[model samples]
Target: MRKNRLKLGLFIPPFHPLYENPTLCIERDLQITQFADEIGMSEIWFGEHHSGGYEIIMSPELMVAAAAERTKSIKLGTGVITLPYHNPLMTANRLCQLDHQTRGRLLFGGGPGLLTADAHMLGLDARESRDKLDEGISVISRLLAGEWVTEKTSWYDLNDAHCHLLPYNGPGSLPIGVASAFSPSGGTLAAKYDTAMLCLAATSPDGYDALAGNWKIACDTAEKYGRTMNPAVLRCATDMHIAETRDEAMDQARKGFEVTQRYFANQTAHVANEGMDVTLEDLIERGEAVVGTPDDAVAQIRRLEEKVPDFGTLLLLDKNWATFENKKRSLEMMMRYVLPEINGDNVSRQKSFDWQGEHAEEYFKTFQQAAQRAFEKHAAQTEADK
Candidate 1:
């Protein structure tokens, strides 16, 4: 068992098919957020996208603001705001305000834009996105810290600019994270900024293989800056659809997974041309997803722990691969069964039950003796009265 309990969260890239009603889709997302909050999910991160029709959320801040109103405890995050696309000063200001709006429950996450098309539309060279992200993070971090920044970049300029509204927790107190996939850049950036690492591709083959290596990179980079990487803030993101049985889970998730894979095939080279043909079995066998029972979800999380032992959070990638009812069921099952088992939440309960069983004979004997004594005393009193 881990010394620290692992936390569960949701990463909503929100892969809704083009066929679904967009309005209802967003509504369902909020409903999911509310349900997750009610069930005690630690956090939920919304994604930002510009051109991808499938990932429809344009501003994760708006989603966070809307969700903040609907939820009570679950911390909301921009799974990532693509830094290169936004002005750093404006981005920092919005985040600081959201930190207040969410009552300090906001988590800031930034990344290089995911879509080449989004970059192309902005007339940005996709190759330069990472460098721009690096620059944006520096500027945004400073602005959020209430520093008056006078910096100029090829894309944007900041002239003694600072956020009027600092974060609710005060300057340099906001929890920030950087999105990391197969590259070491995320780890390096996270180390440089002392932010959390959101391992967005944790369950994927390449990403899984890179997990330990990436953490090592982060530690090494942090060492260079005389800082230590905190494993408690490291979050691993993966796809999962759990039910009472593997077959049922597969049945629920199959069609939607196929649709999502087809969409991926069109958008990214990560999926092959025949990606749509990939089945739930393939996903499970390849270890890319968990489409099974709560036990299987627990096992998958343990597997990730074995790779990166102290990772803080398991962020379920909200692919909407299962129907809404089944999806909710999956999350409930995780909370009721998987989480307790993994975190040892039931250890004391189980021990108390066993202790009572072990002492049952002695307890029964004492109860019998006390009843006999009471009966004898009552008979003596009756005889004396007679």
Candidate 2:
């Protein structure tokens, strides 16, 4: 109902199959979260995958916990957890407990399993995925609203089982969300439950225009019930990377991003059995990509705002999966430079790369010598021979 403008979120891609060495990845994600908090970035969300290259793991709850532990002020979400795949009691309990744990710092996001492989992994028929989604969601919704839900179905049943756990967030609704990718069913379900909707997309405004149109269709279908459902919390993923120089940032981003994109495009290809061609320029023009220099990119984001008046959040795919160094650089650029400008929070002149890094290190070296002299004297005086 709170129609705040331009919320920022991040999508973490599965960088490795081994899932080894998440300490660095965790730190990097937290760093972005911390910075977003500092800069008043509105919200943050990660996603879920069972197997495949999306690497964050099969659990958005765990990743949400990780981010929650590191941040106090930002709204953390699952972007969406595939609801149909999990037991409703466990799933509802997790969302309730996490909401309690973070003092309601959680956003409950859900979706039917996107991947057929995901349904297969759980030994469920792919045909039943969406049906299970409805059933799973119904159980959670009832329990959260303090209904003594009898989970009576092929999937589940709970006689006299309900949440006395937490007070209802509102008279009629739980803090529920749904993820949809051009599926009319996803949108309609969100509306049916009065849950917020999180829509996922790869970059390419051309496709994005098409995609948002799909959401509108879902929204229109939801409108048949009327009487004013909430204003609708809708989100789109933006693949993001920002830096001092346009050319350098794009060059660094290209190889790493394309590799990550291929992983996703391939997953989508197999699941939907449909191939998609995603482009950088289309991403930029669509206003959902993580490319471009700070200046131009901010303008593009604003352009997206104009194009999609209902846009709620810009989810950034800021991960540079190739290396810690690249990932850290991407984070720094987004936080220190890109986020502020795009949020309209700062307008300082960013003549960053126009001046130089290599060309300017020498100048900083002279200042470093002066700083060292001043620091040594200050330390000697302050420590007093210790």
Give one digit per residue, the lDDT tens place, for model 2 in 258-278: 666666677765324423466
The residue pairs that clash in candidate 1, if any, are none
The worst-scoring run of ten residues by lDDT in candidate 1 lies at 267-276
Task: Flag regions of model 2 displaced more than 4 Å.
Answer: 1-3, 17-27, 167-174, 202-207, 229-232, 265-290, 318-386
Question: Model 2: how far is 82 from its true place, Å?
Answer: 1.5
| lDDT of the candidates, in the order given | 0.92, 0.65
Task: Please give the clash total of every predicted structure, in order.
Answer: 0, 10
Q: Pick by TM-score: which candidate is best?
A: 1
